[model samples]
Target: MPEEFGPVGRGEAIQALSREVLIRRSLDISPSGFITIISIIQGVALGLLAQNTFPKPTVLGGIQSVTLLLVFVSVFYYYLTMSVLLRWAPSFLDCFLPFVIASLEIPPAFFLGNAVAWNAWLAGFWFLTMGGLMITTKWSPVSHFGNVRKAHRLLHDLLRELRYTAGIGGFMVAFCALCAHLIPWQRQGWGIVGAGTVLAMVAMIVARTELRASQIHALYGVNRPPFN
Candidate 1:
């Protein structure tokens, strides 16, 4: 290992890691907890909405049911990714992301309850919000490390990954917007929205996994691949 990347000493390394952990815990625990609460609310509300809205099978029932199911999965995926990010990386956006997710639950529920015809718009906005955040923000798990260069390198890598995520998000937003207008609110339209949501979810999953890998590299400092 290079001198710059070498750990200062076992005791100092432990102290640095421990302090970072403590600081993160203090800063992030509440945000993560709040996200979890919101996730529960979203899941329950969406479940009830699905139950009421899609009670019987019809000509387009299969498509609508599958689309709703995909939306539910997307919500669950968002909760998992956001909770992990809140727990691992501190950002000013933390204060806002949970509220955004909470607010989004309203649209679908309202649309279902009142029979509004804006599903495409709703889903398009979802992709745009999530992607925009992923592209715009910077988050890092390691702030204090015995090896300062390692910490900086990890932060750099994480930021680079965010750039890649942003590119994906940009694509998703454009595709979703185009689809939203083209089909608007047909059975096929919901399916299109579901496809865009899946892409957004995949991008989020990739970003989350990158974060986990960076956290692991920060802690373990293994020569092997971070994923392995």
Candidate 2:
């Protein structure tokens, strides 16, 4: 059975073990902790607004306030997740690249959300920026203790992952742009854009899976014919 499975490469084995540890540690924390925390914060804010404890603002002002809040929350979440992932999976920086990319969207989303007042153009821009960020972060340098060599390896792996992720992002940008243009400017348009966004997200996930499989094949030398 072991032979049938082929020789286990040390790097592959380490990656597998590290991932298992990450999973186990993640499970130990309350699965709903993040959701619960967010919910509580939102509920408190809503209650304050309802009781007139907070001064009412114009619609644009409200949007800007919410966008700023989201930006801060997203940054905090990214820091927390990265800290945990780095501690758990020290070898592969690729695992955290997606999170970093996603986190970057918060800033731009905040800007566009405030500017467009939920306009499709802003929404589409948010998705496009998010996708682009994901692709960009994959190629960016990763540093720990300023070790140049280690950082380079991490960056290389990140770029490999990004190359796969960019395909998904490209599709999303196209779809979002289409929806932004096609949908009428109204609440219903926003709803349609939201649906399209979800579809794009699903596609991104599929792309990631396909890319990982390709990477594994390449790693195993399956793509290269043996010397005759």
Candidate 3:
């Protein structure tokens, strides 16, 4: 390796790695956790509203179901990708996740949602590009620069939010596309009502998180900032 990429002493390397592990552990979240649960609630509530207020599906229901199943799989692929990234976990491919996601998810995204699919695709594209740069340039996937644990932390934080952004955005748009056909265009104004309801749900989720954080702070005298 070039001097620029030479290994730090073992002691320093160990300390850096230990710090990275601590941050990743602190930032870890499960797919069934609060943020994902709330997003699921948001998607479901909107889907229900559109269903009750619009034309019932007859034949298209099956097709929509299949299409949506695929879409869900796409989002789940993101979920899996993020789960690994959250811990700065390395793949044998050295970060081929986004490439895999882009290949498998983008097709369904294009079929399920135009703008939403692009949102999904863009997430994969970014990871693949950034990951490629990190790898080829000989940066540790977890630490790109020396003596900068903060950079490692930043990567964890960025991937966490990016996962949520891409996954939730894609799911929300997919929900609409799947159900929009149920309501005739003339009556589809109710879809807005569903959207509004989802917005309200998100607001309530945020409020609840803040409330819980405040309660924790009061009880334990620790700073508890609200987060997704």
* Model 1 per-residue lDDT tens digits across residues 55-120: 654433344444445555555654554444334444556656655655555455434321123344
Q: Is candidate 1 or candidate 3 better by lDDT?
A: 1
Model 3: residue 4 alpha-carbon error in angstroms: 32
Which runs of model 3 end up more than 4 angstroms from their true locations? 1-98, 104-142, 184-228
lDDT of each: 0.51, 0.42, 0.41
Better of 1 and 2 by lDDT: 1
lDDT score at residue 219, model 2, on the 0-100 scale:
49
**CA lDDT of 53 in candidate 2?**
20
TM-score of each: 0.51, 0.29, 0.29
RMSD of each: 11.2, 15.1, 15.8
lDDT of 3 by residue, 113-212 (tens): 2323332333343344344434432433544323345545544444444434434544554455445545446223433432333343334434443444
For candidate 1, list the clashing residue pairs, or say none.
none
Off by over 4 Å in 1: 1-28, 56-93, 109-119, 122-136, 139-190, 193-228
